[model samples]
Target: MQSVSEEIKIRPIFNTQGVCVINSVLYTGYECTLFGTNSQNEIVEQLELESEIVKIFPVYDKVLISTITGKVYVYNPAERNNKLQCVFTNSVIKSIDLDGEAIVLGTADGSVILSDVQGYGETFNKKMDGMITLVKFISLSSIKRRYNSKNKLVAVGDAMGTVTLFNTTGEVVYREKNCHSGQIMFIGELGNKILSCGMDALLIEHSLESEMTIRNISENIDETIGACSLVGDRLFMCSKDLVITLSADLKIVAKKRLNIPDINGFDVFGECCVITTDEHDIVLASVVQDTLVVDKVLIGDNDEITDLLVMENMVVVGTNSRYIRTICKSDIERQNENGLIRNKAFSGELVKSNNEECVLSMCGSNKVFYTGSKDGIISKFEVVTGNIRDSVRAVKSVSAEAPITAMCLYQDLLITGTEYGIINGWKIGDTLELVFTASASSSEITGIVVNNKKIHCTSKTKEIIVVNLNGGMDSSISGHKKGMWSISEHCQMLLTGSSDKTARLWKGDINSTLQHNTSVVKTLLTERAITATSDGVLRVWNTTTYKELGAIRITEIKDERIWAIKRYAGTEYIVSAGPSIVIIKDSSWEVEKMKEQMQKEEYIAKQHAIIFMKKGEYVSAAVEYYKLNLERDLKDALKRITGEMDISPLMSVVLLDSYKFVKRVSKWARSPYLFTITQRILQTAIENRIEISAKEADDLSKTLLRTAELFNAAY
Candidate 1:
């Protein structure tokens, strides 16, 4: 398999429902299209079904697909007109997993059905008392070794926060009620233990022993764990916004928060793990002492990464669009100083578009930005910045089909101009509305700007028209020989680029027709005025002096035309937008300064926590450690304050990690002072209304009582 290129690839899909990888091929099923890619990242097969496919599974040479209409179809990619293999008229199939001798299907009607490979004979079927969300197949050997069972089993996780294990014979091997606070999202077998996670921010590990005891290992309120896998002694898991590695006992050994969209799925590859998210990026990470070190990040060009498959030395990735890419592992393993696997050069094309609308105008202040497409749609987003990069959240949208040619933002008002020379003023509150409309020109409005309570607009009429906010023409300056293509204002200077292949820099009022000017090829204004014309060459000039300082050629494209130049505030970088978006990084030293500030804050907090702990202020120390969110430090504080106090933090720990409390107390909390402390902690927790699980409370009581009897006998 070849490595992915520096330029991100693009794939198009109608609507991606789910993606899965089997053997050496990756399969993604969307609206009505089922596409497959091989290890080489080449499209090998595609089958368009009748209905939207919800889940897909490959069994030997046949592909099985479950649709939204509660039916399953089996077909060979090489064949046509596939017949319905099976129909569940009453139950909508939500998920499918392959087991030893049965295919398990989870349904929306709280039932699980196990059938033969061809779906002709039923093996086992049962209602799980709630909507079945996920069903994981457990091999017979693992179940027999753990619980001494003689039958193969399947683990069913439901929406009502229950996980039940049943044999292929429809007999329940073990059932844990209230395994999580909310609906269970994932269920899998991690080595000898049953691993499950839910929307309640809970990760549970259930032993396969006949007793089938339960333990709550991790809890994160901000995100929910969606996928997990086991590699050696380390367990890798991912949430909507984080990827973490934990010990077999469930202690967070390392973690990395990507701050991206919701994670769809992930699979482990060698020492590294590949993760897929709802956006157009795939992250590869490895565990290194208390940190999930990011090895590389694969970003797609205007695409959302839906699923991925990991082979020996290569990885196959699927996107929302029609493209699948295979990449070699060694290509990303190359070291870099910035720790980013990004292409040094910046160029971007439109990735996800429902129509052929090109983005024409974009403007924003700070992190909130808006873009206008040719289809007359305006998209609003809030930017989320982090230590490494930034992402966005779509806020709202507005639609109008006149091909918004010009836009300006002023306080709570947005002024827009259409190609038909119509200027519309809008008020943005709960919803966007047009408050006033006026005829600015008879020709297409090319560019618009708002300054000092006045809107200045340029059009194909070869004139700059000025209008007041209340809606009346203030002035008009006509000088350019041809229609204006772009316009900008800086420090009372009006810069205009026209189709005559020339740009003029006029340093005077718009009402004045005569001013000292400089003839240039084409021009855009930021801190400095940048010009480009003929030769694909870009020259930067001082806005005040108009002196040429530096120059570079746009070699990424043959015919380069710079249409828009936007600078991100607080950074020296600028984004040039046209047929493609290119980022020009001028000063990147600011990134190091931001990293240093974060490290200093963490160091100061840790020192303060140590001081508080040394002074025997357990509650104060615990509060500081809680800010760090390390389980070991929090447990130490809990042990120190056991009998002396009952704080809310301790109660949270009890509810979040009960297994640690019980196991740790049994091992090190054996002395008389420690035993008394343990008793007091549990007693105070029960009296003060901590929501400890029944299973945990019982285990703690039984273990303590048995230990007390042994101590009395020894004494």
Candidate 2:
């Protein structure tokens, strides 16, 4: 419910995996963990391949990845305790098959080779018309009326729809054409039936008993069947939009939509589906749920982060040569590293660490840190040990499509700042739980805080906004008022010191008016009227009725001026930090009676604007104060006070009506999209006024667009 503070970091996972989801299972050969999804999904905890993976095979606890170079990288989930890694295969291990001690390899140029794990290798090259696309083992019932392992046949589907079947003994059994109308996509077996589906747009049901192709499926399908598998009675096929779960007869039982873009890899485990998107985001969700939740987002920084450290009594922060930084915990920062400086802030002599890459970070606790760099490498930093560890964990998050700016720790959560000026947060752990976050219109967040289930953030626009932990914004308080020299808050009262030589009491919400000077509030003629309460008195106020009020008489100086006052405990003391300093005699009084008088405005409204014309009284009350250098001259302050003495003080009500209208427009953005038209009035005003800079106008345009997005999302 709390708003996400301005500074947080995040990555887009939609670009990595193309339609096929990535499944982040343990991998071998990369020397790093990979977070990949099953099909076209992005893989979580998967390693980014130094080379492109052309093919993959998931066998029980091991996943095999093959590249065009003929080498195979094997990842054993059991051996590494399900950690992602890369295992090298000396030879370009192309297509592989497990046949007891012998391994079959399909060469790049239409040749079949044989090899053994014990170093024996042989070239089983045979004359072929075309290159092999896929190899599968199948069994057909024979005269013996029994199907066993040795009797099983291997089916090789070529790029040109040619189907060649070979017995386990390497003898050609059956060769056929017209088997598929077009190029065959793949062929798999279910029971005694041979299922073939591909660009021909059909699932051919081949019968073992008839030794012929049976039914050609051409029903209830929108797109071409992509990756498919079967376990027991269920047949699963992935289409462009949805994953269809079918029974043995090809009857649709359950269908789930694959809505998000760029799914790289995907896998089904029991009732849940684990998927990775091209965006390097990992999600594990139930088939029944319409919206899937991201389990974890791998932190992938394509830069080289050199130095890292945990700060004392604060969150872990790291630095890189590119001036990129992050705050993280020690343990998480140690997941992947290439060895560098200590992961902590320097003491005494400050030296910038020489890191080569732009740093992206995720923090654990207040002292553990993790940083990712531009070279697709990650480093982990441990503050307590003062050491950097090599890749212990793999995070595949990316930011190439967009730049990530701010990142932080909200309690135990992760907050990230985006280039779009959006703030997003998620709970940090093995599971990424969604936390509340927000944006400051088109403003970027520079600081954030969380407490009492409320998130408070400060933005580049100089606004402080409060929102719920779930991102419901409560209030946005504007920091500065136009034309006011300085405005600040102390205790609960809003104080405004203006160039008009007046210090006015503002309601905490910038409402209400002070009563003492009905028309002319705290304006003074000497150009010096800023009030504060410290010790026992605040000078330059009506000391007649306020509690612990005070006045000062600077006999040595020429003009009476009050710059600042500080209230510590219950006493008021004044300090002159500006150009003209003044020493004064104590003139103080209690403010209780003054507070009582402020509650009743009619009693102080005895000034009649119609009948009695009082010249000096009204004009003197609204006096303007300009701070003149005491060291040079008191002539200006002195001359102005005497000259304005005979003038009648006039009161002007503060202009808040325009701000009120803007506030209404902001509220309108939340419920309707009509704020765009409502803002036409603001455009007219800008056209009448001299716009600041072209850049400022562009920024305002973006702010308006962001406001539109915010409002649109609300509905």
Candidate 3:
């Protein structure tokens, strides 16, 4: 299986500064719960985030956060021993900003929410025209002729192309009439001009006085721009492909586009652009010969950088692993700067890749790429000339015994779905170790996609889970059951078309069997289907209306039930593969057996364990003895047992695990089998000089002596 970091893909850090931070909900990379390289360029206090930090805004002292599951958290970097103080509210925060407890949040319903984050104060909610994408205070404005100081002016951008400016003291000042063509990525105020950037490469310069959209920049750019910032007329805007700078009137000053395969987000600090990549590597860049030159790299231990922050000269990074990174901007910026690239761009390092699983999914640019594999490995490969680069480890292999089924890339983050019920994310970097691993559902994640709100995923249990991703890497599970599979936008809608012959759809996120409780919204039978096979074909069906979209004749069967159905380009040609046949479909689908056969074996093992537990107290003790160290020694031990007995490896694990949970065991005076085994273990321990409790060892020795005497008597 592929376990090398090079095999997996990672996104890039689009921005950075004097102070930067990364927030994650599910994992921490460098063995620290919360590790931050302080301004002193050393890892300081390690702390855990309250839930999962999806977005973090570094304020004066503390940081404001929006969680994946739609919660908000305010963390204070008081001292090394400061406790993580947080609060929860009912409203789901889509985006956030920290203004001295004046928490400004972009809500899900296209509202800009202002909360007094300092003390126990009420959160103020107000609606906007469209779903809010970003909310920011007009910190500093143009060479101010005269602008309100105390009465803060806030800029709110939304899903649509509109960006409105609201004053904290009172009414609207000026709204950009034609802000952007589509969704506005971000908006900010630079001097007197209003800066707005969006999905398309459009960044408009408008006058605060006239409210008129002036110079529309993106003139020569050829990629999607996600964010924009400015330092007195020198405009900084990020593109889907690179970071570009413009003059006051929208003239292209300089462009920094590192041919990164994937990018998450980016920040700018004092002549440096801290770009976080998909592999969790923070590339610190500086201006060198008219280009944004990369001078240093702070590699995150295989963490998917969900949100990047640069606050008050302090750096913070959050991961999907439920941890916040307070790293020093200098820690990453401390590297040798290379002049213009001459012959070889730094040494072309070649190393042998040690990944076990083969490739399963891949994404990235023409120069670099990242791949996710069966062995849980996330690796990165460089495109040297026209050949693929060697495998360099990025994210460590995961716990998924089955192959990684799906990979979705956004910015610098890679979201992976496996056959097991796990959706893990990893940032791309030099080392391949898991920085954050989250469980979307234990339903065997098969597919993952990112929309405006959350990262939508589908699992083997045929459930769609939508988790708000902006809340940092550790964002919570909000948008619960609405995904592409649900077929409908309603969270109540559900469907069952795969193996369970009679396709059933539900109205809630619950399993189909529990639909009776939530009301079965709709149901359709795959009536003409044959017995379930691994490679069987499947056709599309409607759950809400209970209608099969295509004809049943085309959804045919070969040797086995189809495990997966894939469509290419348009819906015309498709591919459905399973145990044997990879049936290319014209307009068809299939049903197949559940892939988790090991779960059944594990259940059987647990049953056997319970039986053994009831045998006697001594026998029960065996459970804990073996299971306590199961992950360490027991895994290989169980592997040996399965190899010897031809038993299911899953069963062996469950049986051994029973030993770990064995609280008590009993030895009846009439049970000879127990006495024999106990005596043999005691004798072995004594011979190997391993310690055994005095009283227990004595009892075992006495039992053995008595048995020996009995044998002598019988002879």
Candidate 4:
């Protein structure tokens, strides 16, 4: 599988419905798209469907996807075919599960459908009360072999909080009504008991023999249960801000408070869990000492950004909220230095406005900055350099009859545009003094630029009004077929972005209209003219030639809109803001090349290790696999090392701590020869008097005794 290139790094800008992890690949569904990511959080595959994705089922080597349009398709990533095979179509599929080739689908209309993947196979359909929310095929053959009865069972949960267990012939084996107050979210089988967690924040355990509730758990959970998964003998239930781990007997093992307030989806893989938040951040967490610690956070912004201003060493971000964030360039660089796997949070300083309304526009020059709010209030702020850090303080406030929409600094004047098509120029000193006022347009003014002592502004009426600084000599220029959103000026060139999905550059009468795939929302000018579109792409165009240079996709969510783009003044870095801020450096191409080289080298080394294994050079192959952190391959190679003479080299390769070594080999206790060899290694380590903690030694000793019992029982 081809991984995502290093030239592009995705910081999530929106939440997904759910996440699934299988074979080390994470699958997530958002709107009409399904994305698959590898262990490194890089996009490996993206499948765009016709409708919104509803549910995903991992069936051995293939994946079955259900959409809101009631279509079911099967995809096999291991195969060469990229097209999904449509198997069935019915009412909106809410959940699905598979046992071998038998497929079970639960629909939103409270119907259960059982069929095979070929579509023409013998099918059975049954209807129940309320919408069917969850479905699973559980086997109880091993625990009930003495009954001499059918073991394949189908468990279904409905929106009315009813759970029903059925046999293959459509016979209802057991039924429980009103198991929860709200919709059922999850259903799982634990030995002879059935586990069900519901949106009512309740986890219920039901006995198969008695057909009654064995236990009901609602402690330490205040929010609705969103999802649940089974790992080993433990059950993991997740709410919006909490996760509870329970033993097989329904006893709470650990309760962890995940600080994320808006969790959209989460999935547990091995000892770690991945959480996707509505704030567009992907949080990676793991249990350490019974506490869930956030190991890394893929940072994203919280709200829609309104404007961005580039200053000396900081980038000021104005959001739709009544607050502006100041991000230091040095802080961003420092976070980037923590390696790709570490946390990437932009810990910026937040400055709140006195106004209760949202910010609409912003402009700054040197240490002084101004912000215009939706309530016709404009606040002036100055940067206060303190002993430790820089802060912003409000200096003065001014108001107009209408909301301020755009602002720009020209010479010694601060020119502002209002929603009522009014323009005013003010001189900045200890206080603001209005010098000139003009009626600019017929509609709300969206953008403003001052060039050659002339004030030019564009409005929602698709007209650009140009006037002198004295508010005289006003002339209207036909701007675009649609409303213009942004405007920029560099020397004699004028650039304007419009809702007509085009950016136009005008130098005198000669103008060039650059067509884009989506509506242009913002335009910026550096050495090149850059236009940001609603499709999350920033396209760069040569100003003089009006030729397209390249395009960068700033976000994965299509049509998310790029609100603002600015050149980090006097640098090759470009800062773009939307739901999050992204800074792209000029050396990205070289960095991409270096990363490609590293991946190639790793692949080559893996190939060499495989060759060594095939050639019976187990010691060399083990070393190479250890270096690559391929634990499975390293263990397999170590198992091949036989005879007492090879013990020295084997000990050198298995350089793990005493506890970890026992834990590793305990998983393979069924293999008699390997277990014997591992026993010899442990004895040698004890003879060497390797230092170990008392807790670790006790745990190691218990694990070894269990492994020995299993080995003897198997033999």
Candidate 5:
């Protein structure tokens, strides 16, 4: 019997920060802690900063931390707090990079300033237009010295879409105006070439040869390129719409469209690239045959991932909303190689509460599930099966004086809002630990969400209260004139439904998306704003217009009163909590699932074929392998049955994975029949002028010489 591991591959990293791997140590800054970890990303050294850290840069043996208040702190294990130095600036520093012995700072004041680490004084400074977004250090060691012996180069990108390259001696080497139509987000260098990508949706390459020449390497790709990195000779760029890899010659090697958007950052190591999405999705993609194919995807329990560092065997992720987490790269690869069975939507099997009271609120990640009931009890359940009843294991229970109204997961913390207007936060691991409890509202606590290191909670008092996690001066945000029921957030917009018979959309920035007045009784947000009313009609509103697009009423249900609305991305289903947990049937979501099912079937068939091949059923396995477009497996099956079957039928199997087939045949150089198979395949490849690597050519030469020697010895 074959055993399959049912463990979820990727785990959650609570609040994270920008991560980088230095000499096998994962360095990252999250919230107030700047830490270093081992290869498995286990924290070995931790230091708490005075203020919240924004960015982390590794300069030589020390780690430099840039704070939100424009203060820079240099941390060294050998130096104590008093012995370590700090640099203070007036304006906010958005980005930092190391150039030679000087630390380059990109400030919000639109200036690129260099602070010498040795002297702890400003060595050079130059003012630019708009806020400086990114600072990158590029070494010109490979370039000829005739360009003035300046081996150190610094590239600064600003919000106005300009990229300027400066020499170590404060001399301008290259400048490009409007290199990107929008803010430049990324700047990476490979040899003498520089790659820049930004909101303009353009990827431009600049040559640092004799004269600086700029070229648009990518077309006006419609999606904003959020992050980019250079790996070997390939440049990996990711955006909301797609992930693309381009060669050094400006030709695209691979391109993959994404179903989910907003890739916060990515790091490339060897053949695979680790991707972190804004919604806390970590994905692994492999480069094969000029195509970037998604090998594995792990949905985090909670916490928005901010950045990641890819290592040879592991990945260290930093999050803005939680602490740092380390995941094994081998686990991701193993799950990808072996078919991974994804979690399906909850089949409406009720897990009755201990007191038989109605479960009011439910929120969970893939790892665990939490439910709150009218009994004033909060229960933690481990996910076990597909159905709700079987999937839940009542592990721990906590009680509140009042009935629980709302619940949310933030990293390891589980926050609960109760009717008594109290907010409780619990940190869960081997056991549940109550972190803090606060009297947040005078009336019933309605909705809650953690954002910007603050807890935003709405209540029957008709106001939203914002409290910092670290405990400080709390503030109340005024907008809703009546009691609020539910709150949902997407991107920068927060949607709330109030008892005043109105649904309000709060924009994080000046540019708001909600245009029309929505009078829906309740507004729940996801990628779209979904609303419900007393009229028993649930409507979907366009997020841009905030206008009704469609309406649906559940079949056989008369009341249609919805207590809560939730979006589940794993199954692409929108569920409503009311008389019954109703799954609103969506055609688009169903279509994607249908496609996935079809592909899953094909994958399962391929796995069965491999199993059959191991059992020595060649003919039947070959047919199944052919259906999966696994040409190499089909060829191997043919090789085993060479004398038993005609070569014509074996050759008829159309080769789809030619690269894998050639590479496989290259290994069977010692076998007489397999050697002939290898020679014939290479001959056909040469005749068809198929692309083959230099390693494959060398393997073919050795196989042919060995075959010739074997033939001479036989004569």
Candidate 6:
């Protein structure tokens, strides 16, 4: 299977925990490291910190990172010597927000401190009843213009589920006791309303005038609200497995299930939202016509895969969760070819066949599969045709005395090995009837295989127990120093992975030992022998020559282990699972060529745009820059076009709908230079009597005024 390496392309099929976006760059905090990726999902920087990161906030061009140890550090990515400089050290900081130069910190000890970034000391400090969970600065100007002098009000959410607003003098302006049944997850402002979501799965909008809830919604959201973000006027709330979008009136606009159950962090920029999962996967989604669409997923380890089975046209994956996901091979191919949008969900059917227990082993024939669970229950399911709510139907289930750890099918018999080293043989028919049972070893059985009317099984005893077909002990082979994890047979050749950090290939009495850097968790035998180790790497070896070919790093995260790897029969598709599910397809040269061609076209267009800009062709350059999403260059070209008297050249930038233009230039609100240039472009358009819809004109005017205020505060 040396050709498998050349023909196959590995892609994460399913989609970090702490993620935020600022100025188009995505920052994700994993462990004690902060990773920054650009819009194209390229790693821009990686900063290692002293402690586990708790929260990250964008402060002008710098990022303020708070740790679990109550230390705050400032990171300036553009600096020559990029380093984290400690700014403050106090009690554990649970939440943080910045307005102008003032930093508001909510501590786990129920203290809220208002300090400056310049280390000038705390301007105001106060203690509350419960541990502060969230703190945000909300502007009071919208409530009353005269209050603008003392406009900044601190919105605080505590562990007791209370929401409180305080002025600069620490006097409570508004307080709502027990606003939620659980700890608050988010607190922010939407016009004159204060929006807050909590672990109780409630999204409440409080009126600034009356200090009461204007609208509270719990419909369509059943899990804890992990995070919430604002895109334009829409409020997007992310729960365990769903993303719910609400309108300004707190009405449910759209809801989508991402199939990612453990969301750790989330943030939004423009129309795009980024989610980080507990497994370290980063999912980037966008709002398209009111629906949340997953654009790309940076897969991370979320669950430990227990078993893999290829049944019919589907690759069934059993994870640590109670469900088994069956991915259609055709769907994988179609998604790989047409890009992931053909099926909006971008996932497969989830079958909860094992009740609440984790699936340990799987065996199948044709469209029928049997799963063994940790609860010692065996469930048989048949894949049904057509659009059924349940993709698989349970035909029968049986309880074993011990947890089933390994299973295999031989002709009309199903053989299973259990946690107590008991080997069982059942006659397959209308009902699963036990035919024979024998003690294989004293330790837990890990693998079982039947060949030539003989049974070969490995267990925690570090020995391969051989038994006759009629429940009699034949002999035992000993070689491995530790318990074997997995075993497979192909044409009389046997491959076994063991906890001793070695995979041994045996043909007759002669065996070749393939040593790995870590414990071998899984092994597969095809044309080549593939072994998965605890070091998160797959080592390929030529079965015939027993020579190591190469290794693939399956998991990028540190200390992550590969738990399962299986190849689909008669196809070049392989599925590996650990933190995320990855689909490896063979004969994918066409896709690679297509990607290369697209990159070439983008490079050519960027070069042409640069040439046009140098030659003073502002309109032509603006068109190219806009198409390439080079926002900086596009804005510069638009500013230059405004200087000319011709209204047609200005059309290249100002002719679009106001919402699109506002979103495109929203990032520039932090830069005084770009902000002024944007203002000049808008002024020129109005002065030239450019025809624009009344709605567009109003939206543009409001966005620019808000941009002006933000620009002044940032500078």
Provide TM-scores for the models. 0.45, 0.36, 0.40, 0.53, 0.41, 0.61
Q: What is the C-alpha lDDT profile of model 1 across 1-715, one tens digit per residue?
A: 1110122222332134344455544566645767664433333556777777776655555667778777776666445454445545555777777754568888888988988776577887898788888888886476676666665678999988999988778888788987787778667766567778776657777765655445554564246666666666777667766777778677777767765556765655456555556653455566677456655544423232322323334333333332233344334232345454332211111122232355556555655655565667766655555454343455777886687767777888888888889888888787778788879999888888775568888888778888888667788877787777667777666777666656666656432221113223345666666565545455555555555555555434454344444442332223232222333443323444565787898789889989989998887777677667655785677568755464666456554555555555555344443465567667765676655577866766777777677768877
Evaluate residue 366 in candidate 6 and report its C-alpha lDDT on the 0 to 100 scale. 83
Q: lDDT (CA) for every model shown?
A: 0.61, 0.41, 0.45, 0.72, 0.61, 0.73
Please write out the lDDT profile of model 4 over residues 410-488, one tens digit for every residue: 8788899999889998887777889889988888888899876789898887877897888774787785899998889
Which portions of model 4 miss their true places by more than 4 Å? Answer: 1-18, 30-34, 47-52, 98-103, 113-125, 137-152, 189-193, 208-223, 231-235, 244-261, 276-284, 294-484, 489-521, 531-562, 568-715
Task: Give Cα distance to truth, residue 85, candidate 4, Å.
Answer: 3.2
Best by TM-score: 6
lDDT by residue (tens digit), candidate 2, 1-715: 1111111112112222211222333222222223332221112334565665555555434566665455566655446455434443543333455555555555345655444533355534343455565566564465114434444566666556667666555656566655766555556677656777654556776554467654544455565554455545566665544566667776668776644323334555555555543323334545433233333332222122222233442232233333322223332223223342211111111111223445533334434444434432233343443344221222323332223344445566665554445566666565445465566446534334454455554444434556666667688655333223223343344444332333455344554322221111112112123242212122454322222243433212233222323221123222221111122222222344455565454233323321122443322222221011121122222222343243222111101244443443344333224454435434544554533456655655666777778876886
Evaluated against the true structure, the overall lDDT of model 2 is 0.41
- The backbone clash count of each candidate, in order, is 7, 139, 130, 0, 10, 8
lDDT of 3: 0.45
Candidate 5 local distance difference test against the native: 0.61
Candidate 1 regions off by >4 Å? 1-11, 22-25, 37-44, 58-62, 75-91, 140-148, 207-221, 231-233, 267-274, 279-715
lDDT of 3 by residue, 513-605 (tens): 311122111121222111112333234443334443443222233432223222212322222222111212223222212223545655665
RMSD values for the candidates in order, in angstroms, are: 29.7, 28.1, 21.4, 23.3, 27.1, 22.7
Poorest lDDT segment (10 consecutive residues) of candidate 4: 1-10
Q: Sort every candidate by TM-score, greatest first.
A: 6, 4, 1, 5, 3, 2
Model 5 spans > 4 angstroms off: 1-17, 23-25, 35-45, 77-84, 99-102, 115-121, 139-146, 207-222, 257-261, 267-275, 280-715
RMSD of 1: 29.7
